[model samples]
Target chain A: MDENPGLSEQYRTASPWPFFIALSIPLAEAGILFNLFAVAVGGLLLFFGCCAGMLQEAGYVDRPWRSLVVGAVIVLAFGGLLLYADTQVANEAVQLAERGYAVLVAGIILFVGGLLGEVFVDDGEFAV
Target chain B: MQLNGQLALTILMGLFLVGVFAWLTRVENWSGYTPLSSGGSAVSGESGYVSEEKPAGIVRWLTTVDHKDIGLMYGAYGVFAFVVGGLMVILMRTELATPETVLVQPGFYNSLLTSHGITMLFLFGTPIIAAFSNYFIPLIIGADDMAFPRINAIAFWLLPPAALLIWAGFFPIPNLIPAQTAWTMYTPLSAGVGQGNQMNAGVDLMMLGLHLSGVSATMGAINFIATIFTERGEEVTWANLDIFSWTILTQSGLILFAFPLLGSALLMLIADRNLGTTFFAVGEGGGAMLWQHLFWFFGHPEVYILVLPPMGLVSYILPRFAGRRLFGFKFVVYSTLAIGVLSFGVWAHHMFSTGMDPRLRASFMAVSMAIAIPSAVKTFNWITTMWNGNIRLTAPMLYCIGFVSNFIIGGVTGVFLASIPVDLVLHDTYYVVGHFHYIVMGAITFAGMAGIYYWFPLVTGRMYQRSLAKWHFWLWMVGTNITFLAMILLGYGGMPRRYATYLPQFASLHQIATLGAYMLLLGGIIWVWNMVQSYFEGPVVEDGDPWDLEASGLRTVEWDWFDRKLQTKIADGGEEEPVTDGGVVEDESADELDTDE
Candidate 1:
């Protein structure tokens, strides 16, 4: 039987990434608006995770774990830069350190998760 | 660092979603939806290899990326938003009836007014147009589906969260209250500086929701541009591309430019509110007028974004009922493009009363008035198309006629406002309100209805009750003119808008408008009931050309696709297909009967 009933091979049937990607933005926004660190870290993690998943699903990346590792490095660098700015700058209202903390924590969790996936999960083993 | 109940709830919810995402990713069967039945494009035998299994119930809707299914979802979502917006205005109109804040407090009234405008424009207007375009664009252009079907689904899925965020203030949440800022979200006031509840987190949520909507619209626009450019069948060339596709293409261009600016403006405003930025702060070097400059730049084009598609709807649907090809179809297409280009230049005319430079205002005024030329061209073509032809006054035709009638009034009123002198007088008054409502409600919504009724059979595979549809049309016609015209009269009497209270002198006209609102409410009820009852219980359409478009050589591609679907279903013994013999091609070969180019 044909996998996709009516559509061509070029079109995706459905993907779980969009739903997660869409859900992640608002959660992140709500976290920032309300100053909730746990929610903020969780949202950023979900957002980056879904992006990597989407990239791998589209075959843009052979190993999404490598992409995630690269993503974690960038995020960690961004967080480190913000923390460095907080030390040099003196704007009371901006709260650079707090934002940096959230980003750093999310980056650390993503790094650990990606490292594990790199060791254990094989490519194309989880293709939906 | 305080762990509160709300924070805990957010964490738990986030974890649950992550778990669901993980589970869904692990499950294997990600091949498209199984067609549950033999009807509806499943047996059309496109690209070979038919599947006999279809997913049933909620799962089919939640995960399917089919353009047709997604279009139906968009339609349902838009209608639901319409009901929400309508109820908000009904409360507002009832309060305006007595002019003494009889029904609700002033703050809540402000909330309702703001929500109504935003909800109607962003929620109902754009999504409803998407509903039509998504379903029909592929069929008409002879594409398999949208260019990026997953992205199309993603675009739609974004809107639900956007709506929830926009309406979050109305939900029962601590420290959250509906933002009283009007749909414009002008600065200084929208900067959360006032003693009013503008400082609430709800305002931030509203802006974010609005930003999400812009993202969704931009994505959809990109898809339309790609699909129309890359996915059109060989026969459906640019020269003969339907007027509706032309308008969608042009509107997508406008969206591609306009919505990103809106998203940026919204983000800057959000940063200003939360992070102490002075981008829109009055005292800290960023002038409040700068916000208006950025907003109306996108905002003015946003008006055309809401309007041009409906104009396409009327242009495309009108001639079919008039029993003629559209008069000046190329001119209509050109006018659509012309409107898209000129829409950007007229943004500053909205700021004439703000004491901008007179020289600058004059340029804006000239461009504003010049933009009216293309609009007038469209109106003229519609009337000329219907002039001497056999005009069938079906429900859709009545709405199209009403669209032209109301558009003339709206356009003329808007022309006067485009002049610096008149706009200065009517800057924030009831006149501005009446003028836009004429275009938005009287013209745009009327065109939307015409499209809906015209394509009812194609969407639902059933016929709507004709008598009830006519009733819906008349009530809305009489109701719209009454409500909006009284507003014009009140504006003439120097009544201001965005007020919960007014002098007793304006009471009678306000009451008249309220009476008109009641009529519209009744009409809306009839429409919903008729559509619902007709979909499940009404007569199922057997003949493919339900409107008998072939009789005038006016049959288009969608109906041909529908004819094929009906033939396939009949061949599979679902229902016997009836012969459609009454058309201009009656004597011709059956194969050529569906050709209408």
Candidate 2:
């Protein structure tokens, strides 16, 4: 038997995405804790961007923006439901409306960004 | 806007450090042991898993997925957390010396109390054990790396952020005070009912941090389980698998079952705090007892999850030092599995004083009492393994012996608390505090030290200062008993726990405990100094078998790997001839090696 292997025989020796993803979560948490709209929005942007990068690097998808489009649609639907609950339900929790609005805005941003990336980055003359 | 600026400054500082690091990597003069993508690539054999041209310096630690590197990072992180937790307790102990909140305000004292408990258990205890398992498991099991390397890295990466979120209350953020709900975070008060800072978003941040930690632990548990199941070598079967691996496998199982429940409960509590849910609201559908039930359901198993690996460590290391195979090896393995399975059934024992149904309480009491049998069985085997054997009085062995002694005290006290009558009296008292500190600090941390000292040569390629190690061990042993025993006596005097100021009757014992904590702090400082100094300047271990394991016929696979690496280094003209400094150069027969039970 081999006493030791020459090196870890694995693909993707290193990636910086996990570090950014880790950083983003606490930033998002800080935003929610302190009621910072801009900080929260920025954190979500970095969070999703890093996640999309990771999936594409792992070859989970050929185009990160395409998968993000699906993610955007799903989050938008969930956000809309939360908004409806805040408006229609009598026993809604505190800040349920604010949380819904935040999620809705995130969904809108992701949807627009994904479409733009697909048009400009993926379908461009110098597409990766 | 100030808060925003602070955040920006923090990000800027982080980027500055990264930039300096990137620049330093290009500077050849800034070198000592620049780790390759794989941690040990420099010493790895031609046939060993060595990276062709791995990134050096900070980038290696930041992004590398190698188990050994990850393990080292876990060790460093756990040590840092331990230091933080230790300092918090030292401050609390100082405050408790006179029991009038002399050192800080009662609110901040409460924050320190909450942070200490969570930090020790979640941050130090679990991750320190993870440090050993992550580093050693793949080596012992003959795996190239952990089953999912990237996922393993992600699991560890989650911790720093989790720590930030958990301790955010202590940071200079506006209106974000630390949580005083205690680590248990019992409901009603935890649902922002208290006049204290519990109503602030700090408690919510703490819960989120706790949730992130739980998620991280769950992911790590899955990785360990998958690796152990799929990665063992051909010769490493269930019958012959090492004891440390067995304990870790069992600990991983406990984590898989326990931490997710904690995550869900934490989420529910956070919702109650931030989203105004009635999940834990006192007058609403959810009641206070629900939180107790859920928390302890995860919490009690969490105790075992923190402990079993230490038990494994002592069992593995004690045998080598005792010059014999561990007696009843099969029974130790059986007891490990038994403890893991029975740990779940006894979570309600923590809820005995919660006024649950008498019948349910009795059943929980029985299971709790029964679970002690497996622990005692393992202890019995450890002692029996050392019985009539040539015992070495090394630092690691002393700590292993200390582990058993402390486990006995801690386990017996825990057993008394399992009884309904006894628990009703001792619940929320200094006695309960004494009982767990005995296990967590006395037993578990001792075992961790034993493992660290035992593997010092293997990890650092140098021997630690023997005299300093002994002093460190002796101080901690004396300090642990003095501090904890005083707490136990105070418990008998009807002293309550978690109070910044106590009745004047408890002053003498409190002072004595504080004295003991000072000793522990001294010992801890010595240990850190020894580790740092020894790693860089201590005598190099020229031989593979540093402890002369072959003399006792107790050499294991990891040592075999070490020996092969040393030989390869010599063959490639890498170093001088092996120096005879208590290490044996000759190898034992394969049959003799297999004689290790």
Candidate 3:
């Protein structure tokens, strides 16, 4: 953990910026470039997972706990909804996969939101 | 034969783009080089570039976050866009010179229309308002700078690439079906349906460009809103805030609500085009009307977004030129706010013919008619402002007068179209086209031209040739009336718009419109010439208040700064290039305060 970071170092994020950037590109190029959006989503997750270890290393955000907690909560809530829709919800009411996908997207968006929220400012310690 | 040539051209264009990217970024070290970090003069001023050096040459402009510099750039960029858009319209008018195609293919005409519409609205209209807003907002509110400086720079730099992307198909691409869906880019036409070039590659580019514009505008809105809220000087109260800043504040709020939705809609449109989605694709449980709903929602407010700041400009400028106080000042402000509130409500008037519902149409019609009240109030205020005052028939005043006069024609036509029965008859007719152009080119553009002329000395420290400027004003007055008035007549004669060819009966009006267009084109040429010649060769305005209203005590903060800046430039630019080593440029005055202050 560097105490005083340069501009280049300041740009490094605990949030998965690279994953988001890459995922957006491939998704926009869908049908024209490639039909395999699952690949893009998978690659984004993998990239994020690989970079998640960097959260321990001090970057923009010192604590990184709020983003992690918020992300976890979002995933849990939407994940529960998806589980219920798939297993318990009545058939012919809604397409479980589509609902599940939408919920999954919502969960990830919230997760990213929380992730970025941690690093937006240097609020490392809680205010007393 | 065509196939081989197309493939070769494709390869060539691909390589050219690769070369351009490499040259712009890597080869020239353009991106890596810092423009602002040069050890130049940083000035401390009451309401000016406080923390920044006066950057040298191109870097001074490129890296400037100073609201004044940003404003100048916006003004310059907008003028350039206006010329380009004007040229496209000229070509269209040339084509419409006769019943048959006089100059271009039908495809080419469609592309021209598309380019002209987008460029006029997104490129010329918005940025011109920005030109005034960025420059005047802080000056009027007594703020030193915008709330976010870096964000301001970022907002401006987004425009060039957006403009380039929208016009990409004009280059020698392999399958260059330049977007002909018009500026509306209505879906099913723009979506990958019915085959042909309707699913043109250019449509995708235009959509992306539109997306970038939305991004720029939204960022600019955020900056404007933040600045107006937070950056008012201690002396300036909300009650005392100038009309220009007030309108900008309201316009920014509208932009905040309106532009993001437009951006989202554009992204969905892009996806529908290239990503095999059917958000607005017809008959796939998706409807074409969805795009119309999203578009006109932003679209209706977009007209106000273009006109409001200029309306504010007229409110500010007319009084100055007329040598009188603006009558009904509070009422004008109230009306401005009312217009802002009602702008969101009247977007559905554009969709009355879309067959939505009778009740919805009725409500929208009511709101549309209600929206006209504020405009009428402002017009009344303006007329009252000019009534008994010693009106100076200066170039800017003439344009202001032109603005009010032409706005009457444009506004009155708008009320007629606001009625559902009238709109049902005139929908997609040249009447709608006439109404739109009158507001856009007549009211908004006329006011914009007035602002440019009025602020020419203040912005550039030079006054334009008055004789040439008068010619520009008079010609514009005649040309706009003749052209747009003829359009109303063409509509009355049951002529539909967007057609490359028309019936022989409407030919006479189209010819008259074309003749007037040529006059307008000549005036436009004079405008550019005036700006270029005036900036380089025109007499330096030593007296800051070139209008000579010093004794009248017209309270304008921009003139105060303008006076000081001219002193600095004239004083420094005359004898010695000031010592740039210490990172500050000081005028040769003992007192640092502006004379007004």
Best by TM-score: 1
lDDT of 1 by residue, B88-163 (tens): 9999999998868779999999999989988999989999999999998998888888887667877888899999
Indicate the worst ten consecutive residues by lDDT in candidate 1 chain A. A1-10
Against the correct fold, how does model 1 do in TM-score? 0.91
Ordering by lDDT: 1, 2, 3
**TM-score, every prediction:** 0.91, 0.87, 0.77
Question: What local lDDT score does residue B74 receive in model 3, on the 0 to 100 scale?
Answer: 86
lDDT value, residue B50 of candidate 1: 15
Model 2 agreement with the true structure over B1-597: per-residue lDDT tens digits: 987785785476457435534543442111122223343212211111112223455666776667887899899999999999999999999999995778888888989999999999999999999999999998898877787776788889989888887899999999899988889998888888766557888788888888888988988999999999988877888889999999999999999989999999988887677665678887774688889889998998999999999999999999999999999999999999999999999988878877789999999999999999999999899989999999999999999999999999999999999999999988888999999999999999999999999999988767899999999999999999999999998998899888999988899999999999999999999999999998867776768899999998999878877777666555645333342111223332222234422
Lowest lDDT block of 10, candidate 1 chain B: B580-589
Kindly report which residue stretches of model 1 are placed more than 4 angstroms away from their true locations once superposed. Answer: A1-12, A77-89, A123-128, B4-14, B26-54, B575-597
- Residue A45, candidate 2: how far off, in angstroms? 3.2
In what order do the candidates fall by TM-score, top score first? 1, 2, 3
- From the highest DockQ down, the ranking of the candidates is 1, 2, 3
Candidate 3 lDDT over residue span B306-423, tens digit each: 9899899999999998889899999999998999999999888988898899999999999999999999999999999999998999999999999999999999999999999999
